[model samples]
Target chain A: MERPARTESPTIGELGESRTLARILPRLASGDAALLGAGDDAAVVAAADGRYVVTTDLLVHGPDFRLAWSTPFELGWKAAATNLTDVAAMGARPTALVVAIAAPPTTPAAVLEGIADGLHEGLAALAPGAGVVGGDLSASTVLTIAVTAFGDLEGRAPVLRSGARVGDVLAHAGARGDAARGLALLFAEGTDAAGEPDPERAAEVRARHPELVAAQLAPHPPVAAGVAAARAGATSMLDVSDGLARDARRIAEASGVGLDFDGEALGADLRVAFAGAEDHGLLATFPPGVEPPAPFEVVGRIVPAPGEVLIDGRGIDAEGWDPYSGWDGRSG
Target chain B: MERPARTESPTIGELGESRTLARILPRLASGDAALLGAGDDAAVVAAADGRYVVTTDLLVHGPDFRLAWSTPFELGWKAAATNLTDVAAMGARPTALVVAIAAPPTTPAAVLEGIADGLHEGLAALAPGAGVVGGDLSASTVLTIAVTAFGDLEGRAPVLRSGARVGDVLAHAGARGDAARGLALLFAEGTDAAGEPDPERAAEVRARHPELVAAQLAPHPPVAAGVAAARAGATSMLDVSDGLARDARRIAEASGVGLDFDGEALGADLRVAFAGAEDHGLLATFPPGVEPPAPFEVVGRIVPAPGEVLIDGRGIDAEGWDPYSGWDGRSG
Candidate 1:
């Protein structure tokens, strides 16, 4: 795609907030769900079900992503995917997104445009018919993106974590450990201060493991499978954002049931599935004798014991990513 | 108010994300608007009007605020007020808020509790019955707060900026320049490396100018007046966030009519009224013969000429606060 003219593109400081917003507003795509779009103090979204399912997530520069490894487009796409998956976990159809971004004064206008492009593409591909309805921009030393997504359940009851009962089956959809492996690869192949790896080496890695790289940079959650599980009478459902075992413990504790994983049923490497976070796959529990929905693999079963997650009749450490404990020393 | 016990209080790093969330979740108050609150992947909020008004704002540590002048409680209050006012500008009743905060791991758990208290207090005092429904937390180099607010129109049509007629009267509610003046006073008082002003001097300033300090640290936007203006047949409306002159230009451009300020009717110092931003006061225009709503003062009139904002028959510069242009050198 031919890039917008960059010679005349001005920094946010040069054009100011209003003018910058004017430049970016036309690039956003608003769908039928938007009663009112950008350029207003507030955007209006149609709530067909008389209720809106809402979730928000924040992506800080150093902790969430390094500018060197990820482009502005990837950053935008990843941010949207993270929040939209949460809406999907509730068995809802995404309606709209509101993004709040803070960047340095020196940030290029082109970077903002790139981020918008990624947002537009992500919504079109991941949550069709949903768009960027509104946003706010401010100045900060490091770049940050805070996104809040809204969805409509279409009169269906929300699938809560506390609904799983003993004798239910646990299932999942989407890749398990690709994102973690991708991050490991990036760290092994050290980049420059700007986070850019050598072009030839980077291209080679991409060709060898394209899916892994994409998983880390631009995740594609199985959003449709959420509704499918709900239709299949899922008693409890959630997106696995912080590793399978750790997130499973959440459902187990909430539902007062133990999740016993069948090693053969998982069909993935235990090491990867237990430690990798940010896969954004759907994890759901369905009542006994109910066939799991298509694309969902039966990985485990709920037992009478509560608050325990076991694999092959043995308990393993459920520890996963903790933001504060995993402070990479880059942040203050 | 007695401060919470400090010695036993754990830092975010010590407690980790899940435990910290467990502590903070109970402190948040969710009103009837929230069908589902925290602990779930997503929150369900009532959108009784069949539509929802959504808006967001980002507040950075150094650019948007200073810890020297504002406590955690005040920061939370001001953040909620800023976004709630945007919902009010759409002539909607604020319903729920979702906050995303990013801070260093060393931040105290007590500070988080204080922020929650402030959010609860702000909602009860400003938009009664509204509450914080959900939120996200992350680790960052500096403290940042991003708030997204949702509101219900309650079957009333949204008052857009494009509706003002040639003979409409422009009115406003709440204090005009107090926040700006308060910010000026804080700048006058110097701070140390840790964003703390000298103890004795700070106490003296606080005692002498309590209202001014409060205005800057914890603004109380007149949220109720928005619904009243809509009921009184407001043609166009918005919140005065970027100074009276600058924000008026938005209404003038949108409505395609010039706004002529009535200097005598304003009943305030012209410079402060025209240049101060962050007042978060409601600015609405009503058709001729419509009595302005109670507590709304007639400050200007709509004229035949379009896209011009004049005061006392003279064009004045509408420059106001621009975050990108106001980097304070304290952030990373």
Candidate 2:
């Protein structure tokens, strides 16, 4: 598959990056709840009234990303964003983030600095610079990034993927399929006369749509939108890391209901976005009567069903990428 | 370094380990905060104030452990326990965990299952049956486990390593020096006169100091003790992932104070349990007038200094294990 055209490449100093984090953290630190901000064994987040939400995710270079296609900064941002969004989807406001990375000893310190820069940048946007609390670094054969996000629910009900009810309104926030389009562009540019990918496509995509390419490389998950969904009475919510139909099916399975899509409503938008994968938007379900906040778009509906996904009122052969399954360039 | 001897080399899943975790988690699912406990994209822990605590750690088999001496279950438990303790050390109550493991493909699934069992066993003691939420399994050259922990603070102040004062009393909870001792035993056995470990000495240690060996294989962090320290108004706190002197120096540096240890108080304990690695315990400090909590032994006092550590009345060596720093087995 061709990736959409675009790329974001930025670099920083490895030795200075850790020092920068130490320097910048205290300046960005605030709120009484964060007793310990950073530079500690573990950050202490306030959970007044007892209990907190936690989640973790891992990003492997060969499996989850490729440096040839994505920049170090983008990879760092995506790693943090994906895990941060998981905490957000739980209706918990993100409080802290811990990241661990393993890279080859020969990896440039500048690349690591770029990664740290991306992490800080992402944290600045989604968490107001207060979320990233701790991290670790090590040497390995390939790059591996792992992140854990912590959140607080503020005494409200935690909306869950299993809570969608029949007649619930399915909606989405943030960009839909820009990442997939970027990928498509990459493939198309490189494809041989037989319409198969060639080496040149990657370079073309990098030159073409850097922003969209960045979308594939590093997704800016709709963190605020998730909090908005919770405030708007969303019954169930999740981040769209995988493609729409596939992730929606997860909600259906968890809620013990079927989800029906108004393919007409999403067709043009999804098509334009080139929704193949990598756009980590927030997919949420609210009660039938409540309207989603300003940023959300109605994409589907929830219903009691036979437990399966449908596309344009019929089943589609594709869903999304599976890490364990064999790849043939058909899905993602 | 060499590992200790073993009479009965139990495989990964000889006992009913996988089913044990599967069976225990449901029983602890009654808490409302865990709206989406286990079996989901991420576990949802409802925070009272919309904040949570998070932390992560990665352990590579050759670098972090050796299967020659430790059991499969012990590796699993230690891997999860280390991360859980990181979260707990912040004075937060743990709620959920995610584990990712990369192992050789030829490795039996049963061993993987045993690892899960060990993880469950570790969590069971601290979390009262809270479940493993999410994980990734893959094939790699050596076994690598990444575990992340989440927690709830219940709105109380989080005890950080930076809060100690000159007038504070230093105390510790849980066993120390045991894991280091086990390491010593393992090395002695492995480097016996013949390239193999001495079976009789290994058996002697196992019978007389099982807890010490277990500490090396599967550390049991005193999670409740951390929470208790928080409630008791601990000024500073941290889990002893590194050696006591090394970790305490971090607190001293962060707190801008000197730390003085009572060599007499530690001499007996260190001599009995010291193995030189993997002692997972909580070292905390309290105000001068505060009464020490039960199960916590007073070991040192805080002094005025800029990031200095001392034993008895003199400055002692501050060297500890560094993953990237090559090992020479020379005493500080």
Candidate 2 TM-score versus the reference = 0.78
lDDT of 1 by residue, B1-332 (tens): 32343656788989999888887788778876999998889999999978999999999888888665677788888988988999999999999999988988998887777777777788888999899899999998878899999898999999888898898988989877888887776666645456555445555667888887787778989898888998898999999888898888888899999888989887665678679888899889999989988789898889987888988767766677777775655552
| DockQ of predictions, in order shown | 0.82, 0.28
Worst 10 residues of 2 chain B by lDDT: B323-332
In model 1, what lDDT does residue A69 have?
67
Tens digits of lDDT, candidate 1, A1-332:
32433655678877777777777778788777999998889999999989999999999988888766677788888888888899989999888999989988888877787788778778888889999999999998888999999999999999999999999998988878888888777766635455555445555666788888889988998987887888889999999989998999999899998888888877666678778888999899999999988879899899877888989777766878998888754731
What DockQ class does candidate 1 belong to?
Answer: high
Error of 1 at B88 (Å): 0.9
The residue-level lDDT of candidate 1 at B306 comes to: 86
Residue A15 in model 2: shift from native, Å?
7.0
